[model samples]
Target: MTAPIALHGSNISYFTGKLENYFRVKGLDYTLHAMKFPGDGKRIERELGVYQMPVLQLADGRWMTDSTKIIQWFETEQPTPALIPANPAVAFICYLLEDYADEWLWRPAMHYRWYYDEGAHFAGRHLADEHLGSLPVPGALKRAFMRHRQRSGYTRGDGITADAVAGVEAIFLRLLEQLETIFRSRPFLLGERPTLADIGFSGPFFRHFALDPVPLEVIRQRAPAVLEWVARLWNTRASDCTGSEPDSVPTDLGPLLEAIGNEYLPYLNANVAAVAAGKKRFDADIGGVGYRGARYSRYRVWCLAELRRQFEVLPEAARADVQALLQQHGCWEPLWQEKLLPLLPGQDEGLPFRASTKMVGANETV
Candidate 1:
């Protein structure tokens, strides 16, 4: 008998939605332990050496955080209704798309959640305060929280303004347009069955954009097709991928992953760089105001860091595939020469800030 899997998470978290989808797709038996808004969730995460929701406690007592890591574990352990396409090319593409969702989409989503609406803004703050019991009182606590929030505040980029919001909105619209074009032909992003890419993108799509009242309305008005797709994906009842009983790999996925790498990923990478550069400029000029007021530099940095770490873990041949994709997308130069290289110029000891293609495995040091 296998030990039961336990999930510690919140209902409203987009990342949690990602994990839920994984459980459904893999047909894994698991139980969710919903934590109190900020308190219980934060406590468990801190003890486990992570700072986010959707943490997985395996039967063997091994704890995992981050949706990407959890998904990879599922792929290795379950290997059915394959989340990662069998073809190296397609699997790599799925990884890239997943990265985009986890990184790029987070900023705009956070911005809308905390900044656009007053009700949500206050509600989030109160929740945080309550979660941080004995930390401080209301007034001073709010100030401290704001300072901490500014460090990871999601924004269009380093500095966000009303104009920045508009710019990010345009990017979202463009992405929606592309997705609508593709989804019009196929039900899922990859094809008949949902792949890892679909699960990754859906997490944020459902949480911040679809469920949140303010952003939900925005998505409905601007991108009805995307909203529809979200509904279809979430409402799916199938236990596993077609033709796979317990665990079966999809056979025909090369074309889909190649298309993602060749056509979609470049666009996604450019968008991420633009947001990061723009936000950084915004913050430098405006000075640190508050989390609500400052640009979301730290969040962007964290996203990039995760990507770099993943890249390091790929096999050598696999790394080449990613590099080829990055080069074709025009990302190789800007990501290394312009943005990343300058960050850790003199530091050669730790992971340099610049992005590079390296193969890392499950046992490889990060």
Candidate 2:
């Protein structure tokens, strides 16, 4: 037996909830500790080289950051009850879904949490109590600061303008309808047991979509099955699941893949262009929404590069199958749109221990 790892982050944080779900499913022992500001900010930055939530302090005194990398590291260390499916093509599909869920769904998730008055008030109050209690500021003042910082960094400051708000929200609605169909037919995204795909999605659903007031109401009304899935995943343990690996991907997942192809990949391509051109902010028309001066992410540029790297390492047969699936869903062309990605030297090389950048670099203090 090992000592429980110290996980530090706000209880309501998006990435924190994601790491929690992954740890629960894997049956990994961990203790969740609040990331009190001022002190924790400096400590985490020193330990991990970036100020991000859900920093995992291992039993051996080593610290880890970034939920995706942490989960991958555990998957390597504890290979039984694999979170990634055994089928080669299915495994690649899991990576695709995870990436889509991580980077693309994040937009709508933040929009819902900060753009609406109900959601902002609810999350603001919770976060203020959870992380800002040590600031010695008035409770109301802390809540107001939380709201302003989030709205400035994530929603309005990131890209969701009045004209784009409706379109940005429609992304969530479409995802819910698609996921609602799949969850109604299966226990998890792939089959009877959870996979990386499900864990990836837990980033958004567990913290934002299922918990935020506005999106929670939307889920309760239209996608109750998805709501059930949220709780079901948290209660599930990977060691207890006896389901067989899927031989083929479900057809119902086509809608989600199509969305990744049509919307997310294109957005990545646009971000790539922006990074290559040395722009901090750029305008893009994605999913028919004109986003003016939206923040450009160097981290997201690495995400695109990482996805292609994942594809390149696939077995020959698996690569062929993945190519066909991605092509079928209109993902292939845009995925490889940039023949040469403009990446900095050794970007994100020291992941899980040290980070070169945050998801959104503009607002680090928040």
Candidate 3:
């Protein structure tokens, strides 16, 4: 037997939980270990050229980063009981949903986790004990530092000001309702079986939405079916599933696509504009919410570029179908809104092995 993969990251981290869910469902042998801060961060930077969660260390001593790229690499190595659908159009949709879940939902997920006192306190204490226990600082100080750092970098500092709080929370609530409707009828996002779409969403749901106190209560009270999906996905193993792969995207998923069209793509366009203007922060009114001083991300600029690249690689027929679908939901215009994406040289070219930029700030120690 081969040595178990060494998965290093915080137990409660969003991306770590996402990779853990994928590894569990794929039946890959792995062991989870807390990424000791300061030390681990420096080491990971040396190995992967970036400090990020859920870095996978192979038996041969190879290190991997970026949960999305890591999963894609694994899927290529093991295609049976596929996590990504086989059909081209369906697979494209899965990729789209995955990207939406990764970049768009992150705002609300971060807001819910760090904006509320209930969530901040819970996560702060857990992270303090899990990732910072070896430190000589007092536990209370560690917890306090965690809370302050998270709020500073992720929630308030990122753009969830008091005025934007309700709007951010509404995003999560609306998501729960949409997902509840979908999960009420099917066991997975695409169909009766799990797919890349489910795995992508697992990033937010498995760790933040389902684990955070305030959002967990809201989920229990408003969208119990979604709550059940959180547990069901964690318990599911893809090798055991006998369900047929979905040949097409479901109609119920139109709402989610519509949300991406209306809310997410426009935001990406705004970010693209911000990056082009060489601004570190820019304010934009997204989904009727006026956000001031929202930090711009070059990484998200690459996300939009990557989405277009995926579309470009699809077959002719699949591209036609995808074009219609995206157009139907108002995604086509903004998706191609930036005629020339301001991509930095070699940006994101070394994914899974190296990183040119991070999803957010790179100074997150704990």
Give me the runs in candidate 1 sitting further than 4 Å from their true place.
Answer: 1-4, 37-46, 118-152, 155-158, 237-240, 243-327, 335-366
- Per-model C-alpha lDDT, please? 0.56, 0.88, 0.87
**Counted clashes in each candidate structure:** 14, 0, 0
Residue runs of model 3 more than 4 Å from their true location after superposition: 357-366
lDDT tens readout by residue for model 2, 1-366: 257989999788778898899989988888999988889989998988888888989899999988878888888988877998888789888988998888888889999999889999999999898887878889999999999998888878877789998899899999999999999999999999999999999999998899898999999999999999999999999889888878789988999999998899999998889888999888899879888777888778888988998899999999999999999999999999998888888788788788875443432434
Report the C-alpha lDDT of model 3 over 1-366, residue by residue, as the tens digit.
256889999888888998999988988889999988789989998998877787989998989988888999989987776999889999999989998898888888888888888899999999999988899999999999999988888877876789988888888888888999999999999998999999999999999899999888999999999988889999999999999999988989898998999899998999889889988878989998878888788778888988999999999999999999999988999899889888877877777877755444312332
Question: Could you tell me the lDDT of residue 253 within candidate 1?
Answer: 34
List model 1 lDDT by residue over 81-101, tens digit each.
576776665565667678767
Candidate 2 lDDT score at position 131? 84
Cα RMSD (Å) between model 1 and the true structure?
8.3
Task: Give the local distance difference test score of model 2.
Answer: 0.88
List TM-scores for all candidates, in order: 0.67, 0.97, 0.97
